[model samples]
Target: MIDVAELRIGTSGWRYPPWRGDFYPRGLVQRRELEYLSSRMNSAEINGSFYSLQRPERYRAWVEQTPDDFVFAVKGGRFITHLKQLRDVETPLANFFASGVLALGRKLGPILWQLPPRLAFDAERVEAFFKLLPRTSHAAAELAKRHDDKLKAEPHTDPSPRRKLRHAVEVRHPSFAEPESLDLFRKHGIALVVADTAGKFPYIDEMTSEEFAYVRLHGDEELYVSGYSDKALEKWARKIKGWGRDTYVYFDNDVKVEAPKNAIALAELLA
Candidate 1:
């Protein structure tokens, strides 16, 4: 039998107000929402980290909120992907690591680096950024040591090393559909994100990394609005099973509070 233990099903972000009276229990306190979500899902994407560097205490709190088996996939900062465009971002990357991501400890899963829709595929630029990615927590800490003054105030640079870190690149531009992009990601041992974005972006499904596969389900008929039907969920489950590697899937169709529902339903199918 193919081992499904490597599969993790979850939602991109969990703090939606629409989910309050519906998915999340009506009386459940706001602080315990994560605790509630963790009880149902095995994983979640820490998307707030993408907007800005998070504090160490926040990551530590997240560790406490979730179950021991639950994993959190941290999103790479937009400052590195969008603003910096992955150029000369050594310090920015270091600062990101230093800002408390390591505090997640054993619960930390893959790091997702999503490129903007406007950023086309540039082999040299992409490869250069991939070279800077640390494959392990220890290496991340070593890189963290190079962080600038921005993180000097109580930066969580050192935490005992935990599991091997994995990276997944989510490219939006159509230029990334080429085989060369896959080859570059494969060369760096980075998983190419299989994104379902309702035709707004390139939806690539090739498994570039043998280590694992990362998938993001934005929506079905509408971007971040529509929900996946039963057939869609079943198809995804079968595809994940056939991947033959650890796979992480996060539902991003949260505008209608369908992400968690879809994630839970998909997990049942896989189960």
Candidate 2:
């Protein structure tokens, strides 16, 4: 585990009701959850963006609430991946960029795009979507300027003051396992997500980018409801150590309030 690159461990989302008493202190207000969790964990994924667009104020508040070292991985909207199937999504992509995501500022980590199970591998379509993504924060903010009226108020199209705009794609279909998909990632410098879905989805741990790696742990023994056992955590710690690259690991198994506990445990193991 020595000489390995920086490792970040955290949960997918912080606003789960089930975690109130276990992960979060009892009687803690909902608004303070991120503040409390960020003190213990180093990073997390903003799951809300996957469902709908969020305002810049929220992103600013998130950045203000967390510590300086805390980073957030923003989930790309499903409109681009599922509904539109990555076709003619230029506006949607622009809207996403304009939707105050850059407000995360230096706290922003990577943007994650998770595809549905039904969508199979289409190199042309995938490549098009990948090419549309902006590599640097300045480029993303520049693209955000083309956002439509959906944003309503002033958008956070400011240039990124921190790292480059990194993107990670997670495909559930088996077809993406093909080698060609890997090529597309290399060409675009996109990281292939290493998702552990308890066999419910496709698993691709391949590192297509040298910049960083992303891993989503949906569950171990069960989907969403189960927690990682000691042996399971050890296995993952060893594997993560072998990566030797900046890695962000997010636990998606929050159904039973295990995501936070498991994430903290894994973080300790890596530490």
Candidate 3:
């Protein structure tokens, strides 16, 4: 298993609409936020490409700004997976992999393939898509439940197909939180992405699971409509203490002021 203790936690630190009011002056906000976050966590998941194409020079600038250990987990563009089937598309998966995006070298983390609710688990499609991926790059698949029975089954064990690839599975449905699901992840060496949502969701109980933890803190659900709260930060800090492995905690609720503060608080706890 990968050393989970080395994993850093933070939110999807990309400039978005909801944060425009608080994080005005996009360029400055991005630079400062990156600096602040780099001081605490070593990794972040980037969702910028989901909205637009990324410039290599801009990515190089980011690489130059952050520390050597800083890592970036990029979200695959919706055009390739969500909008168009893996079969035919304007932007091929091979092209995206070859793009300077993944060329960030060791600083590049896993490629997140967040599938839509409409994308059910089809063995054929899944097999074909996996074939197109680079063997060395890590991939995390977030599947929204459309087919229940197939989703419950274990990942196919065809060793002849790409063997060295690593995968993390994130399922929104409650059924995925079962012992079977956890066992499946352990058996297949798939990391479970623990999501903190508006309602009761099964986040991995740190005491029980030895697998790497991928946590997403979406601020306080009560204050989500307004923004994040300091109280919520304290609660998450306490919870993270129990995690034994490297944990990735991301703040999706508030990316502006709240994310920096919450990240500081969590880092203090981890320290």
Best by lDDT: 1
lDDT of 2 by residue, 145-203 (tens): 99998874687888848457889999899998888988888889999999999998877
Candidate 3 per-residue C-alpha lDDT over 1-271 given as tens digits, one digit per residue, 9 for 90 to 100: 2324565766677545554445444445545656655666677777776555565566666777779889877777677766785555323554354334544656766566655545544545545565555544343111211112221222221222222333444445555456655665565455566666666444454222354566766656632332345666667666666565656677666634565456556766566
How big is the positional error of residue 267 in model 3, measured in Å on the Cα after superposition? Answer: 1.3
Off by over 4 Å in 3: 1-4, 14-33, 36-41, 85-91, 120-169, 174-188, 200-211, 222-235
Q: Score each candidate by Cα lDDT.
A: 0.92, 0.90, 0.55
Who is ahead in lDDT, 1 or 2? 1
- Please list the residue runs of candidate 1 whose C-alpha ends up more than 4 Å from where it truly belongs after superposition: 1-5
- Model 2 gets an lDDT of 0.90
Q: Candidates 1 and 3: which is better by TM-score?
A: 1
In the range 125-213, model 1's lDDT, one tens digit per residue, is 99999999998899999999899888635788675755689999999999898989888988999999999999988889898888899
> Candidate 3 at residue 241, lDDT?
62
Q: Give me the runs in candidate 2 sitting further than 4 Å from their true place.
A: 160-162
lDDT, candidate 2, at 247: 93
| Residue 244, candidate 1: C-alpha displacement in angstroms | 1.2
Per-residue lDDT of 236 in model 3: 65
- Which residue pairs come into collision in candidate 1? none
Our tally of clashes for model 1 stands at 0
